[model samples]
Target: MNLHPRIAADTLPVCITPDAHVRLMNDNRWPWLLLIPLQEHIEELHDLTHEQRDRFMADVNQVSRVLQRFTQCKSVNVAMLGNVVSQLHCHVVARDDNDPNWPGTVWGFGTAVPYEPGQADELLATVRKSFK
Candidate 1:
């Protein structure tokens, strides 16, 4: 069986759930978080067992709460569309009306501004601390 590249690369930050991880997009303009369910064959929500599905939702809620508290975003946009990656993943983006893509979608607008080294460390620390 083929492995998800994400799992192999160990690129994203893992949460308490064994089957979930967080990927911080290197975007300074927006606080974007990717929640990936670590099941190997899950292409959709129904692909998960009922219990697994419930657990996924719990993870999503917890992440959303943390993002709201830390980012103080005007709105939190959670999406599960798999048009590009074709993986069962969720995007929890913190948005504001004043943002560049404000009142519009954040996808395909422009290149992502990679997070600065110091800021990346800080953001990672904030998320890690929140989970404790």
Candidate 2:
């Protein structure tokens, strides 16, 4: 599937495969990923075929486990809110009480803080290694 222009514009490419596009959110406040299935015209989960659904869950689990392992987050939040971007995407966010939006939604709470040089390098490297 062709990635939505808005998604390509918003995130930095991390790792991608035939079935999924993995990207790191520009905001570094909390470790996050936007996972999009590479299936044509799949605007929602129900739109996917049974095989696609199975593969999609595997992809989600991949990202979720990686985030939990590296971040050691108190909890990991997985959400698929397609309100603004009609494209079906899952947000795998690592969170702790220390995060800015603790006990609340991370959206609209504050401006996103971009990742620093070293932090970005380390994160991308670790994630890439895990996927390999």
Candidate 3:
């Protein structure tokens, strides 16, 4: 299935995996990445073949490594909840106790602060470099 245009390469601030479709978090302060499986009718992990599932898990790990290196986060939270979009996407969130939304869940806390142009560029570069 086609992904949201906003999640596409050109629109995303970072391009970690050249061929793999990746989306950088719009929340500037939080080091986050969203990985959407490039498959149609995939509402859950079970929807994917065994091989595809393995690849997806590996991709998640790769993204975690990137977040760990760049953000130096105190902890990493990975979740896949299809309640909202139902598109079978995974979220890799880098969290720290010092973060504004930290010590609490990132969801439903408050509005996300969009990244500044320069900050976004730097983060984009860092994430892209992490993949290499």
Q: Number of clashes in every candidate structure?
A: 0, 0, 0
Residue 108 miss distance in model 1 (angstroms): 0.3
Q: Rank the models by lDDT, top first.
A: 2, 3, 1
TM-score of each: 0.85, 0.93, 0.84
Choose 1 or 2, whichever is better by TM-score: 2
Which sequence of candidate numbers ranks them by TM-score, best first? Answer: 2, 1, 3
Q: What clash count does candidate 2 reach? A: 0
Q: Each prediction's Cα lDDT score?
A: 0.73, 0.85, 0.74
Q: Return whichever of 2 and 3 wins on TM-score.
A: 2
User: By the lDDT metric, which is better: model 1 or model 3?
Assistant: 3
Q: Note the residue pairs that clash in candidate 1.
A: none
On a 0 to 1 TM-score scale, where does candidate 2 land against the true structure?
Answer: 0.93
Q: Write the per-residue lDDT of candidate 2 for residues 1-132, one digit (tens) a residue.
A: 688888887788888766788899889898989989987777888888999888987888888888998889999899988888899888999999999889898877788887776777777777777767
Q: lDDT winner among the candidates?
A: 2
